[model samples]
Target: MPDGNRQIVLTSRPTGWVAPENFELREGTVPEPGSGDVLVRNIFMSLDPYMRGRMNEAKSYASSFEIGEVLQARVIGEVAASKNDGYAAGDIVFGMLGWEDYSLAKGAASLRHVDAELAPLPYYLGALGMPGMTAWIGLREIGQPKAGETLFVSAASGAVGQIAGQIGRIRGCRVVGSAGSDAKAAYVADELGFDAAFNYKTAESYLAALQERCPDGLDVYFDNVGGAMLDAALEVANPFARFVECGMISQYNLVEREGVQNLVYLTRKRIRMQGFIVSDHSDLLPEFMAEMAGWLESGEVKYRVDVADGLENAPATFIAMLKGENFGKQVVRIGPDS
Candidate 1:
């Protein structure tokens, strides 16, 4: 067993964009599991866009990460010690742990055993986890896509967008996606079975691109990158279109968020634009997991992962992810699976 636990702490809050300097790595004594507590040695840690919002002191759906405290994230770990009856040493578990080598899970609510034989441990943090669940709930409940209808997803090659686009295809919708690069666009269209995709970076105009690709107009818009993309989507939306507002990565770092100019189209077209937090829809997780597991097993849905080695690299990896440098779902490998 390791003598100490390593953790990343938020040193300062970012004014605009997050920097590596905002974080500090510290080593401390490994925590021991008390009664009803389980000590887990983390193997993987998920880095997501939502964490950006948590950095700020302002209130949101989740609480802010306090400075000088260990950052929290969805982590997959192996039980190192256990005082809880439900868990034992050598058990693989998934939970909301911290950005550290070892975490002490207090109760059953904090951890759940994961089957390593079913899938790779990392998949529990990506496709079978929060990102996958986000895609499922947002598309099915909010987007409400129909067969032969047109669906457009912004940030199409991203964690949520990739799964959302595939789900749209399963529903028999013509799925169109917008990515940051030509390669990413191609991967979404060719590899992930998107009907059409465009590189938003090189496109002459978002409206023109959408017009060219989605000639029939969009019936559902699974929005991830907002700003001008959201405006363009609104302009090309059909009457009674459903806009599933997932995340706005484009405006996350900006001091002033960009306003949508084509919102007038929303009223004219009778569009329904609804934003959601994935945790609020946990009621659907059981159904989602059953369906998603089948799709994955049947090769109907595919996923990609962008892994960064070591907990020390998490700060830089997180910054790059915010800038769209990551190709897929970004996660950190803190320790070996064994």
Candidate 2:
């Protein structure tokens, strides 16, 4: 156990774009665990697009992060001290813990043991974790892409989109993707095996790019970077297409969100557009973990991570991720694995 604990707190709410000033790091006493409680030494902290919404004061699907309070994230940690019958010291676990060196969890409800031998600990924060499940549940319940259908994914090289497009391939769908850069687009097409991909930032137009990539028209749209891309997807969507609404990273920092003017396509084409949060489908975790892990082990699925070392760099890493600077699943390596 460390003599002291270090933590990051939300200093203020952002009007639009989040900045490093919004977060502040502080030193504190290491938390003491009572009965049925566990003290975790956070090793890998996840920086996700969804966390941006929680920074606001306004109410939404998730609770807001109170000012001056330690920011919470899905963290992979080592159990340093435990008073719970379900857990013991030296166990590796996952939980919604603070962005700090040490986090206190309340028994199994707040933590779940993970096998480090099964996959790297960081995989729990990416492929075998929330991002992977987000891809699975969204496709299973909404996209429902059929074999031979054309499926498109925006932010194709991102944490969730990369997984989603590969899952589409497994289902025998012709997958297309759009990324922020030519390199990312190529990575998705060449490395990740997408049928086709384009750099959305360099595209002549979202609709034009989508049309060229999805010549047959889209049957399923796994939306991550929404806004203009969403409107374009509507224009190219085939009748009875399914649109799975994931995070909208492009619009998350906008003062006024862009409106979808092509919504008429939803009714005219009989398209089903639905939004989902990965946490809402906790019951599907076991199923998602088993399937994704097998795919990863078999080389059917591949993943990438953009790691920033040190806890102090978490704020900068998070800001970079939102700006589309990170290559893949962004994680902050806070401590040594041992």
Candidate 3:
């Protein structure tokens, strides 16, 4: 075991786009577990869009990250030491741990045991973790998709979007996706089984693209990139359509958010547009896990991971992810599982 822990801390908050200078990498002594706590050596750390909201000074569903404090993320790690009865040394676990070589779980509350045999360690951060849960809850609870309906997903090649689109397919819906690149669009349609996909960047207009692909109109719109896409979805939505607002990666870094001019369609079309936070539906986790685990085990669902090696690169990786530069679920491999 290393004598010191390497950590990434938020040195400053961002005004618009997050910069690498906003973060600082430092080394400190490995944290010791207190009573009822467990010490974990982080193997993988998840990079997500939600973390961007946390970096700001304003409060959201979760508290903002404090300046000079170590960043926090969903990490898959092995227990190095344990004072908690529920966890033992060598136990693989997943939790809201820090962006560091090691993390001290103050209590077992945020941590859950991970069966490494069920899936790879990194899958817990993507497919089997928060991203997957976000996809499941948004589609099942809010989207309320039905068979033969057309479903559209923005940022379709991404973590939550990929899973959300696949779930639409499993529900017997015709799933169309919009990605940033042609290759990403192809991956969404070809590899992930999306009915059709287009590159939003190359498309003349989102409205035109949606109209061409979803000729019958969209019954469910799983939105990850808000702004222009949301506007287009509004225009193309079928009457009584369900719009699940997951996140707005497009608007997250903008100094002034882009406004949707077509919201009038919501009233005219009787569309149900709702936003959700995954944490709010913890009760559905067991049901979600059962179904998701089965899909993962049976190979019904396919997931991709974009990994950045080393803790120091987390800030760069996170910045790239915010810009849609990452190809799939972005994660930082900070330490070896072994």
Off by over 4 Å in 1: none
Candidate 3 regions exceeding 4 Å error are none
Candidate 2 TM-score over all chains jointly: 0.98
lDDT of 2 at 57: 80
Give the alpha carbon lDDT tens digit for every residue of 56-171 in model 2.
88889989999999999999999999999888899999999989999999765669999999888888999899998999999999999899999999998989999999999999
Total clashes in model 2, counting residue pairs 3 or more apart in sequence or in different chains: 0
Candidate 2 — worst ten consecutive residues by lDDT sum?
A: 106-115
What lDDT is reached at residue 122 by model 1?
79
lDDT of 3 by residue, 149-199 (tens): 999999999999999999999999999999999999999999999999999
Candidate 2: Cα lDDT at 55: 96
Q: Write the per-residue lDDT of candidate 1 for residues 1-338, one digit (tens) a residue.
A: 77889999999999899998999999977987779899999999999999999999999999999999999999999999999999999999999999999998987466988878877777888889999999999987899999999999988888899999999999999999999999999999999999999999999999999999999999999999889999999999999999999999999999998887998987899999999999998888789888988999899999989889999999999999999998988999999988
TM-score for all predictions? 0.99, 0.98, 0.98
